[model samples]
Every structure is written in structure tokens, then in C-alpha cells.
Target chain A: MNFFFGIQNNLFSSKLEIPIFKNDGTFLEETILYKLKIQDLEWKIEIFDKSKKNNFFFHVNSSDVNNNDIFFIGRHENLKKFKSNKLIVLNEFTSLVPHGYHYRSNLRVNINKGGFSSYQSDYPYKMTPVKGSVVTSLASVTNFNADKNYIFFKNIYELPIQENFKIYIVDLKEKKIKTFFEAKTNYSNFFEIKKEYILPEMFLVSKNYVGIPIYISEKNGQISMEHTNPPTSNILNSDRIDIVKKFKRELNEIIN
Target chain B: MKSLIRKIINLDFSIQVRNTLNIIPKGIQKKVSNQSSTSDAFIWRTDNNFTTKFKFSDILKLYFKIKKSHVELHFYSKFNNLITIKKIYDLDFSNEVVISKNLLGGIEDYGVFYAYHIMDEKKSQNISVNNKCYTGFSKDKEFYSFVHGNTLVRTFDYYTNNQNELVQTSFIKNKNYLIQKFFYSSEKNELFFTNPASKSVKFDINGKNFKLKKGHSKLISINDNFVKIRSNCFYFRPIAFTYNEKYFDVYHC
Candidate 1:
């Protein structure tokens, strides 16, 4: 508790400087987590109130400023969309006061999923603050630790008495599952897709980029979905449809 | 020349409108942007060092509801098994206020994940009439153990004695057999147990026998130096002796 307050106080007093990093173009594909860079190691802070509203402020030391113009940019989650907001240009250091209505829960000083830039010249790129749909083509930043964490998602349906099926790595070694992705219900039709279980290395690398396809099958008295084949990268120049296409292809491969 | 001047005036007017729209508040920015197609762009920079510096495995986040107004956070750092408890009073997205924090030796049992407050030993005492496995720590915080049925199934002790260094000790119990009675005497440093039999017979700490049909207590004495068959013995301090099958056998020793 003391350490947390100490960190926060140091941030506001400009004794601590937090670096913000971005890798949007060619470098996005190579790394699982992007690294931050510091222009002058300025103190970046986000203060929040009880109303679930937050304010972002940056304290710049006069000695650290090598340029006159400073550019501050913020990207935060808006409802369901994660988009970049307007860029502010500050001439004087005092102009870097607290601004904007940030969500309290989403406020963070360093461990956030956005970028900030402070520069002397005008921002080279045009700023689009409009709320837009999330881009699926962007490389995912999710990573799973084999020892502690797992990739968890659900495939739920409501039409037939509410069927909820989950996919999990039951056996990481053999990638074997006597029953995987099948909704455990009184319903007779339930089969899991098992062929898509790739090697541990490949599964860990590609699980974030793509998802395993669910295949529906009719066998004996049960009509079930078979879980087969591991997921592959859908990164075809930022097209999310690659995920659907990969699923469809795997379904066909299992059926034929 | 007149038409060219008119086109330049329109361009200037649109840019002015766009700049004016940006000045509106954030809540209104959404509605106004929906009406018009213009927007402002901002570059996003994330601190990637956060993810690299702390792996998800290192920190186990546990939430405990303290009253209705606030929620207590227990961040169990697996690196050193340090438990830091912080509180958020308003239940909003604001920074949490540190209430009280302490460092535990390590995760004593699998129940810590399910247990809200490990300090509250009663919370970890999971009991059932049928065959059940229970995990918890001893009172003095010196010893942690997992018991199944009537046996000290697994023990994790952090005592620093040359003879009995109480670090982590995981003992796998035979799942097929159910221990009807288990007694551990810290004074003697011995353990005793029996299998399911007549409920009329109950063994006390003095190794006095009521019935000896399925008693494996004598056999334990041969293998384990901590087991002795004697009468009029001094009761073990922090004795983890199970009197009945229903009681939680967590002792201070």
C-alpha cells in the first residue's frame, strides 16, 4: 500500500517519469508486447474521481524540454471501440494541465494500451477522433503463460435451451481431449473438434491471431460440433475474415 | 476569378467548423461527430515494458468484498509468495487505497485461489460427509497441511529447525483408503491414524485404544519417528488431533 502511494506521489511531483511507447507500422507483427520510449522521461499521470471520470495530465520539467512544441495524444476504449482521440499541441508547459473526460476504470499512467507523442514540429499525421469499429487486422497483444494462464473464450447459443460450450486445453502434451468444446447438457448431439490441436509452440503463438473453427456433425443419434485442428494466423493485411475462412476450411477438411 | 474566391471561402469556413467542433466537450463530441463526418486523430503509445517486466504468472489477483462500500484486493505475488492487500473504498475505477498488507510464506494450498481471505482459516476449511479433500494452514502460521478424510494427506511446513525444516512438504495420500481418525502430536513429533470402522470407538491423544481392528497406528510408529504408542502422554501443543470426522483438524502447531 505504501509503495503504491509512493509511486503515485512521485509521479505527480515529477520525481518519476513514465515512458509511453507505440509500434503501429512494420514493427507490430514481430512483437507480442510493444516497448515504450521516452523523449525526456516526463511524469505522465491520470487522476480519477468517484464518479468514474478521470483526467490525464503530464508534468514536464523545463530542463528536459529540448523543443518548444509538444504533442500529446491519447487512445482509450470508447464503449466497444478502441480509438484514438484528438491531438493537443501545447506551446507553454503550463498548457499541459489536466484535460479530457477519461473513464475512471480505464485510467492508467503506464500500463495502458495506447500511445503518446511529444514533439517540436506539427504532428505529421492527420488525427481522426471519431468513434470507429475496432480494426481486427491489427496484431493481437495477448500472450498465455503455459504454467499459470490459459486462453479462454465461450461459444454460447440461446435458441436450444441455452447451450454454452467452452474450449480449453485439457492436455497440453498430447493435445488430446476425450471431449473438447462440447456443451455438457442433456442434449444428445455433442461432439468436439480435436484435429486442430497443434503443437504447444504453434498453439501458443497463433491462438491469439486466429481461432479454431467449430464444425457441426451428425453422428448416430447425436448432431454435434467437432473440434478439430489448431487455429492459424488470419493476418492477411488486417482482414478479420481470415479467421472465418480458416474455420470454414478446417470444417471442410474434417467432414471430407 | 470570382468563382475561385468563393471556393477558397468555403474551404476556410469548413476548416473553421472542424476546429470549433473539436472544442466541444467529450460527451458532446460523440453526438456532434455522428452528425458530421470530421474527426481529430491522436497517436497511441503503450508502455510495453509493463507487460514484459511483470508476467501474468507472477501476480494472482484476488478480490474480496469488504462490506458493501468497498472491495479488498489481495495481490499474491508468486515470485516470493508475498500477499499484499489493498482496498478500494468507492468501488469505482480510481486508484486503490492500501488498507493492510502482509507477506505470506507461499501458497500453502490450492484452496488459496478459491479462498477469499487466507488469513481467515475458517474460510479454507472445506468439509463434507463423504470422501473429501481439505486444504488449510496451521494456526501459528508455521505449518500448512492438506487433509483428506482422516489423514494428514499433505503437509507444507516453514519451520527452520535442523531436524524438521518446515518448508513445503506435499504428501500424496492413498485415495482408495479413507482415514477414519488422524492425530498429530507436535510434542512427540509423531502422527497416528486409523481406517473407517465402528463410530463407537474414539482415540484420544494418549494413544489409549478403544478398538484396534483396523488400526494402522502401530504400523506408523515403525516408519515415522514422529509416531509413538504410549499412555498418559502429554498432549501435543498445537495438536491437529481429529476428535470426530465432522470437525476441521487445523491446529496451531
Candidate 2:
């Protein structure tokens, strides 16, 4: 509702900061919640718009220099100089999962068994899904709290339609799901993850790590992943299957 | 390496980027409903200090919308009960901004993590800090209390009628533990945790060390009577100053 201008009004400014909150499903609300201006000819300190009521931001870590990076998804090896607000863009489609957020995309895109895509709304237009082989099946997109290094989605056709929900804790920075359980009333009054949301138990554990994800069927506390190759990342999940050996076995023809 | 000091005071146009720790990145902040409505306001708040006092609106809904990264909090309330309306993000009026501080090292290449702040209460009188708990006057008219474990315990206001007389020292228990001494100073407006980690904490106050419910933070943070405990990142202000949960008959008084 108010604007403050100064002598260097004509000088360059960082891309005006914009806020995008993921409300529910595929809806987003935009607001210019934060503003930055030169304070005493030096610090371009960032502050709230002052006029706004409440402020919202994605989860952040304490180690970063600015202490306020926005969440983004892009390709691998993106070591490009950030040319102002535009950040780095990727040609490939990326998918996103919420961390401190509740909404999960549950949307899927191109690629074979474990392929997915997440674009900034404008990119993916054929949402209705055109018929045939080009289209892949949709998988349940659950929420996550961190910007993962690499992500792959498998069309999990095995999950049943039931809401036997339980809270799962993933130490994203460490890249692992610490614990999963069926919440029972008074069973776990507090969710150690976010200091909010106390459920009196009545939830259950589902998966461990990147298993068949499809073979992911549960009975009580035990889970079975059948023949699916384990997920690969900076760290190894299972000792049974060697991802390197499997890769060498299948793509021996491509490796020089 | 551009010193964070340099960036804080943005100078020079030819500044090139170096290590991941130099850039001051800004993310999208959104405004939610005030204590009045459930409808979305959709505004952003940049500056944050870890703990987010939940405005009357359900900030939890927003937590689910982006539930990937690690987010934790410490809840503080003057009402002594979660459902009570005197909580910092008291549902009776106005919305509160939520702040997020990075606990890990992720935003080096990007900008640093950011969140919101809970303003220091203006009317909170007598925020005294002694060797014991910080004691302060309550806005609550009917009674006075201090928060220990997500619950409020009534605190007896100390009157200085017997200042010069010597009396035998007796031990009393306070929030989550026992105490051996009680020193409430109105001159400095401070309450001391006097030997908080002592086998028995006896701040001459009248209260027993009852076990905080499962959802409460184990550690007690009392600063000159303006008390706040840390859970994950959020601060949980005790509903009242005593563990006497008398107001909360349902949970455990």
C-alpha cells in the first residue's frame, strides 16, 4: 500500500523478489512479500513490506550465506554464474515435492519407468494428457522438504486407495528417511520433524528407501520391494544389489 | 571472498561471485490469513528468526503444502493451553508472520535461509532476570502464570514485605524439577532459574515439578521473567509460569 523511493531510483536493482505459496493441489498465490533497498549507501538489507500481515518462506538451512534462498528445481552440474533474479534455467523438465509444505504434486511426466517432470507452470501444457505411448502413467506425488540432488519417479501401480496415513521423517540434508511408523493416539504426541502438528498416534510406516516403489505393499510393519533395483544417490541404500554392477551389466554395450 | 559484511552493505557494481556463501538470495514469501479469515492473503515475508508464531490461521496447512525439508519449532503461549486464545499467535486477533532459519548447510550457492520474527511484547511488564526464572506481570486479569512445558503453571507474585527479616530457607519445586531458592526482584523485573540444571531447582515459588506432557520441550528457557523455551526452532512461551495446570483441567492440572 506504500512505496518509498530515493536518489538512486534510476540505478539497477535485483530482480524484484516475489513470493509464491503452494496452497493446495496445483494452486499458487503470489505476493511481493519482501523488499530490498540500499540502507545508508551500503547494505541492500532485505525486509518485509511492512504493510503486509504475515510472512511465509520455504524451509532454509543455517549454513547458507544469505540465509534466505528460495526453493528451485533444475538440471545437474548447473555451475553457472547466477545472472541476477533469473537464476539458472534447465532444458529438462523437473518435478518438486514439498518439505515443510503439505501439497504433493502427484503429477508425472515424460521418461520411461522412473521418469518425471516439473516445470514452472508455463512449460507443461498438455495437462489433460494426449493419448498413446508418448504419455506415461501418473504416480502419487508425496510432499518433501528439501531440494533433492536427483529425483526419479516410478509409476507405482501397486499402492491401494486407502488413507492409512502415518508421519515419516526424512533427514533430507543427510538424504535419508530416518523413521516411519503407524501413528497411534497418544502413541507419538509430537512430530519431531516440525515442532508443529501433534497427532495422537493412528498412523503407519510404508517404505524404507528407493525400493521397487511399485512392489511397495505393506501389511503391518514389514515391507517387501520384490525385484525392483534399489535407488541410487550420493549414498548407497542396500548391500544386496550393486548399482554399479547392474549398470555395467545392462549398458555394457554403451560403455567404452 | 566478499565479506558478508560487504554484502550487508552492498557496494561496488563489479562484485563477482565466489564461494557459495556470498550471495544474498531472496525467496518468495506469502501472506496468510489474519486472526479474522481462512481465505488466503498470499503475501511474502523475508526476514525470519527460526520460530514462527502461528497467527490465528492454521499455519500447519502451509507446512503440509511444502513438506520436504526439515522444519521444526518451539511453541510459546500465554494462554497455557493450545486451544486457549492468549497464545502469541493468539487466534483472537491479527495474523503472525512465520520465519524459517536454515539449520543445515544447503543454500551456499543460492541465498541464505530466511524466516520471520516474533516482536517483543510491549505490555509485558517486569521482565526481570535474576539467578532464577525471569518473572513478569501477566496481561491475564484473573490470574498470573508462567509457561514451562507447553502448559502454564500459576506463579505467586512476590511481595517484599519481609525484606530485612531472616527466615529459614525451604525447598520448593518448579517446572519439570525441584528448587532450593526463590528470588523474585521487582526492581530489575527478573526471575532466576537459580541452578536450573541442579538436581533440584527450588525457586521459592509455589509449584511442583510435574512431568511436561509428551509434546513439550524438555529444556526450560527463562530469561529475566520473559521466558521462552526452544523446540526445534520455535519458542514455546509457557501459558502461565507454574506447572499447576489448574486452568487446563482436561490435559493435566
Candidate 3:
């Protein structure tokens, strides 16, 4: 049975990565992988050079392997070599059954005495397997401290090629649409949302391609990171596909 | 014959039966357009100096010229008791509901709140019936950490006036687990579990045992990076809250 399972190749790969934030404070980042019921699961970690010239693959120390999971903690000295680079984890497992593995990139930062914040990476790989070109996405903006809030767009691809797209910020209250920012695939983009643009009925939309829109806010020493859900999550019935199509069509018509 | 045997071994029949049953009721009530609705079980926190709020919008308004629409928030206590139900009428394109002790009749604690959309069927077309909104958590009013609903745990049929619970037992048990890794360096690492099942659910993190009654919630503290959970329920993922001194982060794990 194990031999047949190994030869069947019924595994789907889930790859996720995040760019290391440049902070003056003490920062530590690690990739945490949780093992479920996948038998003989295989995984790897790769680091992209800041210059975007080289990709290096390394192995996690055997000591870091716990009873049911693996932790690939980054070293300060080694991470300095690729500052602002990307750390990617690729996990291949058979999702044929109902069980699967979970992994996330965890970061801890300490700026001042008794000041610390921890964040977990939320962007899962969405471009791989090339589902489609257009996606309707929505996310809320957190403008607690206007000057300290920034929106991060991390678009990754299985292939090394890059694609250009524009993100539209839709103000439902004002009934207007504006091109907020232009981003390239395979790169991490960050920009500050003006305080004037932040309103109660505000949401970000992307029509060209799909990427993770992460809201990050920092005040004093605390930092909060979160991502938005796909538009289809609003409906739970089997006919959600048709409903989402209508929703997206009407939304695009209104925006255009 | 060999392929049929393989399919049977994979529990294809059981899955097909479950899917058929799920759609049969909807098919029978297809005439009642208002009966279709989608809902999510949101987490509400008003305990230990933590405040929770949910932000939503009238997405169906984009498709139909909505005459009237509102959201029904069914608030539950920590013990899974239905405490209060608040209705937000005449919603704008965007709105928010701040969960507070006073709003919940001074029931101060953490629990689950299920929010569903209610619209005037005569004046509007009900294509999409729910807005799976985002929930925000704040401490001391410093900053808000927001996250969306993680699963579709429950749904309400307006025509039949029946609430359907979705998260429950799977065909196979003890074959699945929910696991997450957290750093031990944080001052506090807590995992919030809400039982959406109609019956009680039994699960354990690491070796510590816990039993959560139907619709109840429990918060467990973790001091290690390696955490494993085994539960009888299908969707047993928990919301993770990590606090380091004055800074904290909340997300679905």
C-alpha cells in the first residue's frame, strides 16, 4: 500500500513565502511547518538574493525537528546577507484524503525595553498552477495611526517571470474608483494609504491578477498584520460560483 | 472491477451520499428564494480587557436595487448560551458592529456570534444572502487586529426558520489532527477554540485534555512551540493570540 501511494503521485504542492521586513529593532523570523497525516512528506526552503540574481536552497538542522513539526529559524548573521529578500517554503503532500499540513512564517520584533510584537505570515501561494488571470479580491483598511499604517502587497509566482498589474481602491461611500498603485509580480510592494483616502466604506480591488493584500499597522511598538478573504468566501452554497460571477461582473461594471 | 474496488476503498460512496443529502433540501425548497443564505460563526471577545468588532458591507446591493436590508447578530455566551440577538437595520454599503458588554446586556466574556443577512425579498433579488465580514480585536484601544471568518460553520434557512449546524463529525475519526507551531519566547500564547457542533466536542492540545460543550468556547495557553490537537470534529482550527508584553497579535491558525 505504501509503495502504491508513493508511486501514485497524488500530491499537490503548496508553496508560501514572505519578504523579511527591514527594522532597526531586533528582528527574528522562522518558518514553522506542522505535520499532519501526510506520510513521508518532503519539503524544502529557498532564499532569494536581494539582488534577485541567485537562489539558494538549504536544509534545516536536525535538532530543530520536534516531535511533530519542523522549525527553520533564521540566523541574524545569515539573514543579513539577503536583507529584504524572500524566504520560501515548498511542501508537497497528498491531499487526496481530508487531512493536510500547515505552515507559516513567524516573525518577532523587539524595538525598545519591554516592547515586542509577533506576526505570522498570511499569504499562501495563489499564482501557481495558473488558475486564471482575473480575480475579484476585497480587504479592509486599518488606519488606526495614519502615519504608521502601510499596506503590503506580496505577489509571488511559481515561475520566475514577472507581470505588471494595477490595484484599484474603491470608495463605496464616495462612489468612486482610483488606481491606488501598480505592482509587479514576483516582488514585494509596500505603500502608505493616505489618511484622506481611508474611510469606512473603503476596500481594495484587483482586476488584473490575484495577490495577497496584507494590512500592517504599527503604533509605539506594537505591529499587526492581517490578510483578506477571497470574494467567494461570502457564499457557502454549491451555486456560489455562479453567484460570485454575477457579483464580480456587477462590481467591475460599477468600478469601470 | 479493480477501479470500482479502489473507489469504494476511498470512501467515494460516502462522500457522494453526503453531498447529495446536503443539496436535497435546497432543491426541495428552491421555490423559496429568500431561504438561501450564507453565514459564518464569528468570534466575539469582551473579556480580559479585549474588545471585538465586526465590519461588513451590503454586497448584495451591488447586484440588486435593495429596498431594505439588515444584519442579525446572534450573540452567545461563553457557556454556549444564547445571550442576545442584535439587529442592525438600514445598513449602508459599509457598516460595523462593535461587540461590547453593554451591547450584549453586560455579558462580559468571550464567545461566538453568528451573523447573517436579512433582506426584504419583495423589493430585492436575493442572489447572495450573506456577508462574511471581518472581525477586529483590540486591547486597551491601542490598535485593532482584524481577521475574516475561517469556516462556514452554520447557516439559517429563512423560509423554513431552521438553523443548520454544519461543523460536526467526519466519516473517519482519529485520522485527522490540527497542529500549529508557536515560539515559546512570547509572554503569552493562547489558542481560542469554539465548538460549532450541536453536540460536545473532545480534543486535546499536546497531552492536555479538553471538552467543549456545544456552541461553547475555550481558551488554552501554550508554552511550547510544538502543539498538536486531535478532535472528534471536522473543522477544529483555532484562533491564535500571542502576546508579548504590551504587543499582541490575533489570527486564525
Candidate 4:
């Protein structure tokens, strides 16, 4: 059955930025399970780590994958994907579904250690390969002090890229904005927000470049990682688009 | 003509009608708008060994910059009975409420909960008053694993000057299916299902038939590597909790 109720004219390439945490006793192993739909599917997987001077790229195909219809991207003998801690995998592929390309593919990230494990779905996608902005509410930040938290940012760009952008942390209470950290595009940047700054009504804003902001919290051996939805998702009615646009504009003004 | 035919085949008319009914200003048709309120429902767990906490913020105040806003949380038992209602006033930037067995008057194990953002009717005339918050589960005073609300279930229309009126949105049971895969291992893997429909929802998982009444929740352990749910509701996603001894994970699938 084919349903195209909300089909758009433009087609989007599926892209996901899966975070590779440091295996410091907490995160022992990381693996990405990508379900392949079409035969001979082609994908461009890039590993970006700050410690390394250059990024690594892997051109993968579904036919060469050994597992049945599932492509595991990390900690493999044949595919030595992880190079350093704090690396990210930029997985990009064309969607087989022409109408609802954005909602077709699913990628799952699993991090585990001896019987203890956690997994999350990497469902966030971008329309453009690069050059878009992200504005989302970080309201779901865990309040447990035992849980160490960090925000993982991933941006894609062309080769020979040398650009840095500022991430603004908006304080909803004080009505103030501060540059939480300076991040480089085309790489995986991980930083922790101080406990003082992790207050209510806090928002993460990116103006120039587009990327995904994932909240990672680890306590003891358990880890929870998930991405916050865009501000537009808070409303479900037809006025959501206009309401979200106004909200974004006001947020941009506060940041500026 | 061709596009219209395609839309008809896709059942676009039903969706459009639903969306249209959702946009009629609140308080205009008190009964209809109350039933269609955009509030989201979340699953909360409390056991002898585990407890749940819901973290939320004044989202309407953050976006609309309203002066006064309050959050009312309605807790229900596994049998779909109203356990209690807690209200948090004098809203701050962030807030959290712990739902231990003691807090629910020492109720049963698990249930469903949702929040209603109450603001001045004149101030919130044209804004959305629903806050989609996150729920965290902690075991034995250990770390809390958190996940956001999954779907829109129910709401109480404060703008209609009838706080006693509870709005329950009806879920459509169709021929759609939502499949979620899991990693089968020696440890325990359980899937929690909550029915958001007004009537009893009958669904099958891996050829096993199960039924959940309105506003009720059930947790069942699964030995299979994946679960395929065939139900009338299109967005019937379940919350998964995998455990190996003390360490565990929680997420929506």
C-alpha cells in the first residue's frame, strides 16, 4: 500500500550523525545497525575525530556487507571504523522511497558493556547536506547529578573546510544568551554544560550551519542518549508553522 | 483530477478532516475542542525497585512569555483509574516531580500520566497550552533513564471554565502496523504498551493476541528479537526496557 498524504516535491537524502563516545569504562563498545532496503545500496560513511588531523572516509555497499541486510559500522574486524574516542559517523544515503524519503530509513546505535547496554534510534535528518541552522529546546536534560551529560554536535561540509561556529545557550530566566562553546564544522564536537548553566528554559541555537544536537547522559553503567525535537514539533495544529517561525525569530533576536 | 484521486486512495480526506477539527479555536465548541486538545500522554513506572520522575518546563511561557502558568499532572493506575492529581504553581525555568509508590498513595506498579499547561485564558487565547515533557525511570536509587512522551492522549480544557471536563481523544484503529526490533539476549527484555484510544484496542504481537482497554497500560516480556504490532491505531509505539541484572536501558520504539 502506497500512501502519499503529505508528500512534498523535493526529495531529501538521509543523513544521521551517530556519536562515538570515549570507551572510558563507561562506554566499552559502540555499534551502528543500519537496515538496508535496496540491494547494492551505496553509502558514504565518514569518521570525524578532533584528535586526528584528517578525517577518514569509507565507501560502503550493501552487497559487500556480510550480515544479512544489516550493516554494522563499528568495532568490526573487516571494517575498522572507530579510530579515536569522541568520534562520529556521518552516514548518508539516498532514500529508496521517492515520496516519503525522510521517514523510510531507520538507524539504531548501541553501546554496551558486559550485560549492561543502552540503545537509541538516530531518527533526526537534514534536508541539505550542509549550511542549515538548528534551534531546539534542551528541556529534557536529566537532573540527576550522578548522570554525566554532554551535547554532541555534528556538521557536514565539503573537503578543505576551515570554519568555526558559535553555539548560543539561551537562558530563559535571565533573558540572556551566551556562547557556550566554539565548534568546527565537518567534525564531531562534544562538550559538557556546567551544572550552573543547565537551568530551566535553556535552549541551544545554531545560526549559520545545520547539525544535530544529541543529549548524552551516563550514570554508573547505564547511558541514555536522545535528540530533542525541533521547536515546531511542540504544536500539532495548522498554526504550528507560523507559531514556530515567530518563536525562532524571537530567539534569533535574543541571541543577536 | 489525478492528484485528487491519489489523495483519495491515500485516505487524505480523513486526515484533513481530523486536522480541521483540531484547529477550531478552543472554547468555541467546548466538547469537540476539549476532546481534540493537543496534550501529550506519557507512560510512568513505579515498582518496589524502580520509580519514575517527570521533568518539564514552562514551554508556553518560554515561547509566548506569559506571566503566570501552572502545570497539572493527572496520574492513572494500570486499571485506568484516577490515582491523584498534582498541580505545580509558581512556574520556574525547570521543574521535576518524582512518582514513587509512596507518592501515588502506594499504588500498583505502572500507569499513564499527562500534563496540562494552565494559563490565563485571555493570555493564552491563540497559543498552544500543551507541554510535551520527559519521563525518567530510576531503579534502586540509581541513575534515571529518561524518554519523552510518545503520543497525544488526553487533556482538561481550562479555558472553557470547566476544569472538571476531561477530554479523551479517540484513536483510529486502522490496517496500519508499526514494527520495532530488539536485541534478544540472556537478560530480560520487556515491552510496555499503553492504549490511547477511547475504546479497547486489540493488537497482535508476533502472532500473540492482546487487548488493552482505554487509558490502560500493560508490560509483557518478549523472547523474540523483534515485535510487529498490527493494530487499528497508526501510531501505537511501545516503550522498551532491557535489563541485565542492575543495569538497564529505556527508550521508545
Which candidate number maximizes DockQ? Answer: 4
**lDDT of candidate 2 over B1-253, digit per residue (tens):** 5687755433222111211122431111111112111111111111221121222212221111112222112222211122111223331111222322232211111111111112222222221110111111112221111111111111111232111110111122211211111112321222212111102222322222323322222223233321122111101122112221111100001
True contacts kept of each: 0.00, 0.00, 0.27, 0.31
Residue lDDT tens for model 4, B25-122: 11111232421234556777876478888887676666667767678888888888998989898887678888888889977488888787776445
DockQ for each of the predicted structures, in order?
A: 0.01, 0.01, 0.23, 0.27
Q: Write the per-residue lDDT of candidate 1 for residues B153-221, one digit (tens) a residue.
A: 111111211111111111111011111111223222223332221111233333435332221122122
DockQ, candidate 3, vs. native dimer: 0.23
**Model 1 segments beyond 4 Å from truth?**
A1-146, A164-179, A184-248, A251-256, B1-19, B22-253
Candidate 4 global TM-score:
0.70
TM-score per candidate: 0.19, 0.16, 0.71, 0.70
List A-chain TM-scores for all predictions.
0.23, 0.17, 0.55, 0.55
On residues A141-249, what C-alpha lDDT tens digit does candidate 1 reach at each position? 1111111111212121111122233333333224333233333211222232233332221122121112222222211211111122221211111232454354333
For candidate 2, give the lDDT.
Answer: 0.20
Q: Using TM-score as the measure, which candidate wins?
A: 3
Tens digits of per-residue lDDT for model 3 on B104-198? 88866898988877766633334545556788888755467777676666667666657766554433234234342333554688889998666
The CA lDDT of each predicted structure is 0.20, 0.20, 0.55, 0.55
Positional deviation of residue B65's Cα in model 4 after best superposition, in angstroms: 2.0
